[model samples]
Target chain A: DAGVTQSPTHLIKTRGQQVTLRCSPISGHKSVSWYQQVLGQGPQFIFQYYEKEERGRGNFPDRFSARQFPNYSSELNVNALLLGDSALYLCASSFPSSRASDTQYFGPGTRLTVL
Target chain B: AQTVTQSQPEMSVQEAETVTLSCTYDTSESNYYLFWYKQPPSRQMILVIRQEAYKQQNATENRFSVNFQKAAKSFSLKISDSQLGDTAMYFCAFMKQGSGGGADGLTFGKGTHLIIQP
Candidate 1:
């Protein structure tokens, strides 16, 4: 089966603008998570959705938001984008039934650049 | 909140030689999990190995093995016969066991860049 998939492999926006990133979880997976990876640093968790409900959220600001669809796909929206918002946005998926020890599979990520 | 640390910013080793990358994490939760993920220039995070806090034995996958010390809070990865393909950014991550059935987000370290010299 295919791994988690993300869209618009790359994106560019100016400061004060907005952008939406999309993700499709792996088949049969019920949970999706979002992470932001700045250049030369590790990824930081942004949001996690399970069974179409918001399960967890990271320390990111309110300008960042996400939602999961009935099909388990997810979208991350960043408003009032700052230069600091430029980073590779990653999406991960896992089976909720597997519980805590489940390993999340990540996507190639959407590279967002803000000028 | 939990914090994962990778002290080594970078490391270089000759091909076919063994190298060990170190990591340490701070967490009050006893039923947590630790992981080592590798990200090549391609930029997708790949799971190398994982260890559960409750497990006494370390996790091993092919040439990859982990030394998981629950007390010391140290989790290190050892690569045997390292190959050029092994070159990548290595990250140590932590996840607290959640009471709910959903998966939790991972807290990652800054990562160590590992170079396998040819």
Candidate 2:
């Protein structure tokens, strides 16, 4: 079984631009979450979707948004990007049955560089 | 809001030696979870170990183990017989137990950089 997978391994965008990052969860997973990791720092939670419904959201600004599809795939969108937005965006997936204490498996992550 | 803190920014251990990474978190919830994740240069976040606040016994996975102190709100990782592959950035994370089986995203620390000397 493949782990979570992400698209556009790396990206470069100018300030004020918008970008979308995609993620495909494991075959049997139903929960997908997004996190942002700045250089030399640990990842910060962004949003989580379970069964195609938004479950939780972090302290990120309104510019950041995400949605999950029927197949449990997810996309993270960032609008009006600022240089501070440059970071590694990670996607994680977990089984819905063990939602409370399930271990989350993470993707390789998409590196976004805003200039 | 819960917060995870890793005081040591960097640490090094010789091959076959043992090393421990400390983590402290602040939370008001009685039931929660703690995790240790390893991020190599490849940027893949790998689950190292986890502990449930309700359990008194610590969690051990192969060469990795955790020292979970509920009273102190501390969860530390100890790696025995360390190998060169153990060199990576390790993060400590927390999650509160929510009702309705809803999943809450993790709250992570700044991370500790571990170097295994061969």
Candidate 3:
């Protein structure tokens, strides 16, 4: 089965511009989450969606938002981007069960460079 | 709130040798999950191993194993017979037990860069 996939592997944007990154979860997965990884740092959570519902959000500003589709695909949007927003955006997918063994699989991530 | 700490920023070991990466976390919740993820140059975050807080036994996958100490809040990864392919950034993460099936996402450490010398 295909793993989590991300689109526009590379992106270039300017300060105050807006950008959108896409993700397609693995088949049969229903939960999708977004994370941002700065160079030399671990990923920081952004937003998570399950069944098209917003389940959780991180400390990101209002400029960051995300939504999940019925097919379990997701889109992460950043508005009025800042140079600080330049980083790799990652998407993860997993089952929505409470099982302790459940694991979240990640994508290759989209590299966004804010000029 | 929870925080994960990886004190070793980088480690290098000869192939076929054993190497251990250290991680410590602070959390008030008793029921949670801990994970070790590997990120190669490809930048894909790969799951290495995981352990549930409630379980006394540690978690192991093939050549990778973890020494999970709940009392010390220390979770260390041991790579036995390490290979060059093990060269990558290893991250330690924490998650609440009922984090809505991980909807709350993971609390990750800054990561340790592991290099296996040939």
Candidate 4:
């Protein structure tokens, strides 16, 4: 079975520019969540989408937003990006919803660089 | 909000030896899940082991086992007979109960860089 897949493995963006990272969840998975991992730090939750609805969000700034598609694929959009936005954006998928202990499978992640 | 902490920023162990990585978390939710994920140079996060709050017995997988002290809110992972393949940044995570049978994305610690020598 194909696992979670993320697009644009690497991206380069300038400060103030916008970037969008994509993720296609595993087959039969309904929930997708995004995380940002800064260099040398563990990942921090960004946003979660289940059934095309936003379920939860983290302490990130307003520039970060995400949406889930009908097929469970997700897009994380960052507007007015800052230098601190340079990090790896990871997409993880699980079945049902976020409250369950369903194991989450993660993608390789998109490495975003801001200059 | 739940917070996870990995006190060791980095640790090194010789191959075939045992090494333990420490983690502590703070959460108000009585029942939740704790996870250990490994991310190598490739940046793909892989689940190592997980422990449910309700289960008193520690969870073990292969050579990986957790020293879970529920009362102390401490969850540590022990890797026996380590291999060079074990070299990676291991992150401890906590996930609380969200509505809807969904698995909440984890709140991760800063991570411990585990380096295994050949």
The candidate maximizing DockQ is 3
Q: Estimate every model's Cα lDDT from 0 to 1.
A: 0.91, 0.91, 0.93, 0.89
CA lDDT, candidate 2, residue B28: 91
Chain B alone, TM-score of each model? 0.96, 0.96, 0.97, 0.95
Fnat value of model 4: 0.61
Interface RMSD of each: 2.1, 2.2, 1.5, 2.5
Candidate 4 residue A112 Cα shift, in angstroms, is: 0.6
Q: Once model 4 is optimally superposed onto the true structure by TM-score, how far is the C-alpha of residue B29 displaced, in angstroms?
A: 1.1
Who is ahead in DockQ, 2 or 4?
Answer: 2
Model 1 chain B: ten consecutive residues of lowest lDDT? B95-104
lDDT of 4 by residue, B1-118 (tens): 7889899999998999999999999988988888899999988999999888889999999999999999999999999999999999999988875564333568899999999998
Model 3 agreement with the true structure over A1-115: per-residue lDDT tens digits? 9999999999999999999999999998889989999999999999989889999999999999888888999999999999999999999998867674357899999999999
Off by over 4 Å in 1: A99-101, B100-104
Ranking by lDDT: 3, 2, 1, 4
Model 2: per-residue lDDT, tens digit, A1-115? 8889999999999999999999999998888999999999889889999899899988899999999999989999999999999999999988857545377889999999999
Best by TM-score: 3
**Between prediction 1 and prediction 3, which has the larger TM-score?**
3
lDDT tens string, model 2, B17-82?
999999999999998889999999999999999888899999999999999999999999999999
Q: Residue by residue across A1-115, what tens digits does model 4's lDDT show?
A: 9989999999999999999999999999888999998987888888888899988888899999999989889999999999999999999988854444366779999999999
Off by over 4 Å in 3: none
lDDT score at residue B117, model 3, on the 0-100 scale: 95
